[model samples]
Target: MNDDLRRAVRQVLPGVRTDLDALVRIPSVSAAPGSVEQVRRSAEMTARLFKDAGAPDVEILDDIEDGLPAVLARYPAPPGQPTVLLYAHHDVQPAGSPGQWSSPPFEPTERDGRLYGRGAADDKAGIAAHLAALRAYSGRPPVGVTVLVEGEEEIGSPNLGTFLARHKDKLDADVIVLADADNLTTGTPCLTTALRGMAACVVELRALEGGVHSGSYGGGVPDALTALCRLLATLHDEQGNVAVEGLATAVPPGAPVSEAGFRAEAGLLEGVQLLGSGSIAERIWAKPAATVLGIDAPPVATASPTLTPVARAKVGLRVAPGDDALKARKALAGHLRHHTPWGLQVTVVEAEVAQPFVIDARGPAFDAARRAYGEAYGNDVVDIGSGGSIPFVAEFADAYPQAAILIASAGADADSRAHGADESLNLADFERACLAETLLLAELTRSG
Candidate 1:
C-alpha cells in the first residue's frame, strides 16, 4: 500500500509543482489595500484547480457581506466510510519591500530545492498539497473528502465563525486535517497539538487640544506620541516579560530548544540578547507576548519640532496556551488605561480576541496520522505548540466537539520565514506531505 501511494505521489510531482507555482504567482494579499480583485482571482483559480482534478464541481462562496470569497467542494462518503475535511487558505501577507527579496515576491522561484514566494510556504503550498493528495488517486479517494480553501487566514480569519455556522452540513466531518502549521525543521515532521490564542487592539492617546511649537512649549508640555511611548513601555518589565497582570502562562511539553538553534532560526543580529527566562520553547510557546505592530504617527521624513496632539498604535498579543484571549485583551487595555502617562486621555479600540486551544489528539485518528507521517518521512513525528494562533481551529472544535482535529504543516519550517520577506517552501517535504496525506486517506478507509 505504501509503495503504491509513493509511486502515485511521485507521478504527480510535475503537475503539483506547476500548479503550486501558478498559485504563488498571484498577489493575493487579502489585507492589502485594493486587493479585492486579486483575492477574487485567487479564489477562482483555486476552484478551477480542484474541479480539473476530478472532484465534484466546486463552488466559490462569497455570499457573506463584506467578506472575501472561499472555495469549497466535497466528495460523498461510500458506505460505512468516515468523511475527512481538508483545510487551507489562499490569502497571502502583504509584501513589505521588493528590494528585501532575492526574487520578486509574487514571482515563484526555485533555488537550493526550495520554492520562494510570498505564500509559497505559509499557505499556498498547503492548497497545493491538498490538490496533489487528491490528484494522487485521480481525485477519487477511498474515503469521503471535503476541500475548503479559505481566503482570510492572514487577517486572523474574522469571518470564519460566520462561514462555519452557515455551512455546517457541508463542512462537518469525522476528521479535520488543517495544513497551516510549521514543522520542527527541514524534513522533520511535527504534529501540532496546541496553539497560543491571538488578540489585538489600537490605543490612541491625546495630550493636547492642538499642536504647539516645541520652542514655545517643549520643556513644560508633552507630546502625545512621546506620552504614548511611555505608556507602551509599561506593558513590559525590565526582563521583557509581558507586564499584563491577568494573563496566564504555562510550561509547554516539547523537546528542549537550544539557544544557538533558536538564534540561527530567528536570524537575530550579533550580540542581541534573548528575552525573558526559562527555556526558549517555554518563553515563546507558553508565555504571552505583546508587540506593537504599527503606529499611526508622523513619519520620520515629515517630523518637525511640534508637540503632536494625538498618536495611535496597534498592539498585537499572542495569548499563552492556557489563557483566555478575551481576558488578556482586557488586561492589556486595563494596563494601558491605568498606566497612561501624564494623565493623558487614552482610548483603547479593542479588536478581535481568539481563545487559545488544546486539541485532543490521543485516539485512533491521531494514531493513523502518526503512522502515515512516520512512514512518509522515515522518522518519528514530534509534537509541538505553535506560537502563532489560528482562531478557525478553535472555532471548528467548538462547532463540533466530537470530531477529531489534527493540525499538520504542508511544508513550512522555522527557516521558511512565513509572513516575512524571502518566504520559501522546502520542495522535498512538500512531496512527502502529499504522500503522507494520501496515505492517511487510505489508513482511514482501511481501518474503518
Candidate 2:
C-alpha cells in the first residue's frame, strides 16, 4: 500500500511543482507594508488548492485585526480513524536585494534540478507537500486530515495564539506535522525534537546630551559608542561562549553533529575558528547564544570627527530548551546595565519573547512517522535539534498537550539556502517528503 502511495505521489509531482510555482510567484511578503492584499491572495489560493484537493470544508480565517489571512480546511475522518493536522505557512520573507539572486526572486525559475524563488523552500513547498499527499490519496485518505496554512509566520506569528484560541475545537487533532523546519542534510530524514526560545531587546547608552567635537574632547570625555561597544563585548568571552549569567544550558540527548558537517553546513570561511566549547551540536542546539543584530552608528562613508552623544544596539538572545525566555531577557538586560562603562545611563527595551520547545517523540504517532520517513528516504531517521525558534510550536504544545507533534521539513540543509540568496528546493527531497506524509497517514489507520 505504501509503495502504491509513493508511486502515486511521484505521478503527481509535476502538478505539485506547478502549484508551488504559482505560490512562489505571489510576492506575499508578510513583513512588507501594503503587502496584506498579496498575503490575502496567497491565503485564498491556498484555500482553493485545499478545496480542490477534496477538502469538504475550507475557510479563510481573518479574525485578527490587521493580521494577514490564513486558510483552514478539514477532511473528515473515516470511522474510528484519527485526524492529523498539517501545518505550513503561505506567506514569505521579503525578496531582498534582487542583485544578489541568480534569478528574479519571485520568478520561480528552475535550474540545476532545483526550483529557485523567495518561498521555494522556506514553506510554500511545505504546503505543496501537503497537497501532494492529499492528491496521492485521491482526496480521501484512510485517516482524517486538516490543513492550517498561516500567513504571518515570518513576522513572528503575533496573531497565531489568538487564532488558535478562537478555533481550538476546529483545529484539534490526534497528530500534527509541522513542515516549517529542515532535514539534517539532503536525503537525510531528521526529526526536530527541540527548538531554542528567543528574546530580543534594544540597549541604548547615553553619555552626553549632544555630539561634541572629538578633537577638542578627545581623551577627557566619554564616548557613548565606545561605551556601548564595551558593554556588548562583555556578552562573549575570549573563547566566544555566552558570558551572561543566570541563563540555562542543558544539552538534549542526541548524536552529536560532527565539526566537519557543521563547518560545511555553516559555510564558514577558510581558517575561521568555531566559537564556544562542547560539541558543535551542543553549542548551537542546546545552549544560549547572543548576537548583536545591528547598531545605530554612522556609516563610514558619512562619518564625522565627533563623539556621538548616544548609541543603541539591537541584541538578540537564543534561550536553551527548558529555559525561561523572560528570565533570559532580564538577565541580558541586567548584564548590560551592570557593565555600562563610565557610569553611562543605559536603557534596555524588551522587544519579543518566545519560549523554547522540546517534544517527547516516543508515542504511536512518532513511531509511525519514523517508519514512514525511513521508508520514504531509504535511511534511518535521526533525531536532531534546531537552533531557530518557532514560537507557535510552543503555543501548539500548550494548547494541545495530548496531541503528538512532529517537526519535519521538506527543504533544509545547506544547499536549500532558505531565507538567503539563491533560495531553492531539491526536487528529490520534496518528493520524499510528500511520500512520507502519505505513508504516515496510511500508517495511522493500520492495526497496532
Candidate 3:
C-alpha cells in the first residue's frame, strides 16, 4: 500500500505543481486593504480543487465578519473510521518591495529545485499537499476528511474564533493536522510539540510640542526619537537576552540546536554575534524575545536638520511556553513606560495577544504520524518547538479538548523563507509530506 501510494503521488506531482503555481499567482494577501477580492478568488480556487477531488459539500464560507473567505469541504468516513481535519491558510503576507525579490512575487518561478513566490511555502504548498494526499486515495481516503483553508492567518486570524463557534458541529473531528508550521530540517520529518505565544503594542513618546531646528535647540532640547531609541534599547541586556522584568522563561526539552545549524538557518553573516544566553533552543523557543518592528520617524533620505517632537514604535514580544500572554503584554507595557528617558510622556497601547501552545504527543494518532513520517522521509521523526505563534492552536485545543492535534508541514526547513521575499517551497519535502499524510490515513483506518 505504501508503494502504491508513493507511485500514485509521483504520478500526480505535475498536476500538484501546476495547481500550486496557479494558486500562487493570485496574490491573495489578506493583510492588504485592496486584496479582499483576490483572497476570495483564492478561496474559490481552493474550493474548486477540493470539489474536483471528489469532496462532497465543498463550500466557500464568507460569513467571517470582516475576514477574508474560507474554504471548507467534507468527505464522510466509512463505517467505524475516525474523522480527520486538515488545516492550512490560503492568505499570505504582502510582497513588501519587488526589488527585494529575484523574481516577481506573484509569478511562480522555478529555479534551483525550488518553486518561489509569496505563499509558495508558507501555506499554498500545504494545501497542495492535502490535495495530493486525497488524490493518492483517488479522492476517497480510508478515514473521513475535512479540509479547512483559512484566509486570515497572516493578519492574526481575527475572525477564526467566531467562525469556529458558529460552525462547531460541522467541524467535529477525532484528529486534526495543522500544516502551517515548519519541521526541524529538510528530509527529516518532525512534529512540533510547542509554540511560543505573542504580545504586541504600539508605544508613543512625546518630548516636545513640535519639531525644533537642530542648530537652535540641539544643545538643550530633548528629542523624542532619541528618547524612544533609549527606551527600546532597555528591552535587551548585554547578553542579548530579554531584560524585561516579570516575564517567564523556560528551558526547552529535547536536543538543542547547534551553533552551526542556527547560523546556517538564520543566514547570519560572519563576525556577527548571536544574542541571548543559554542553548539556542532555549533562547528561541523557551524565552521571551522583543523586537522593535518599526519606528514612526523621518526616513534618512527625507530627514531635516530638526529635532523631532514625537516618535512611535511598533513592538512585538514573544512569550515563552507556559507564560500567560496577557500577563506578558502587561509586563512589556510596564517595562516600556518605566524605561522612558528624560521622564518623557509615554503611551503604550496593546495591539494583540495570543497564548502559547503545547501538545501532548501520546496517542494513537501521533503514533501513526510518527511511523508514517519515518517511513516517508526515511529518518526518525524528531520532536521540535516553533518560536512563532499560531493563536488558533490554543483556540482549537480549548474548543476540541478530546481531539488529537498534530503539527506537520510541507515546508520543513529554513530555506523556505516564509513571509519574506523569494519565499519558496522544496518540492521534494512537499512530496514526502503528501506521502506521509496518505500513510497516516491508511494507518488510522487499520487502527480504528
User: Which window of ten consecutive residues has the lowest lDDT sum in model 1?
Assistant: 250-259
Model 3 clash pairs? none
Q: Candidate 2: how many backbone clashes?
A: 0
lDDT of 3 by residue, 84-105 (tens): 9999999999999999999999
Over 1-448, each residue of candidate 1 has an lDDT whose tens digit, in order, gives: 7898899999998998999999999999999869999999999999999999988858999989989999998888888999999999999999899999999999999999899999999899899999988999998988999999999999888899999999998898999999999888878788888799988889999989999999999999989999988988887888888888998997685756778988998999999988787888888889999999889988999899999999999998999987889889988888888888888889998997898988767888999999899888888888888899988888999998888998998988888999999999988888889888999999887666
Compared with the true structure, what per-residue lDDT tens digits does model 2 show for residues 333-439?
89988989999989999988899988899988899999999999998898999898888899998999989999998755557888888898888888889899889
Global CA lDDT computed for model 3: 0.90
Q: lDDT values of the candidates?
A: 0.90, 0.90, 0.90
**What is the Å distance of residue 47 in model 1 from its true position?**
0.9
lDDT of 1 at 398: 90
lDDT of 2 at 368: 93
Better of 1 and 2 by TM-score: 1
TM-score of 1: 0.98
Query: What lDDT is obtained when candidate 2 is compared to the true structure?
Result: 0.90
Ordered list by TM-score, greatest first: 1, 3, 2
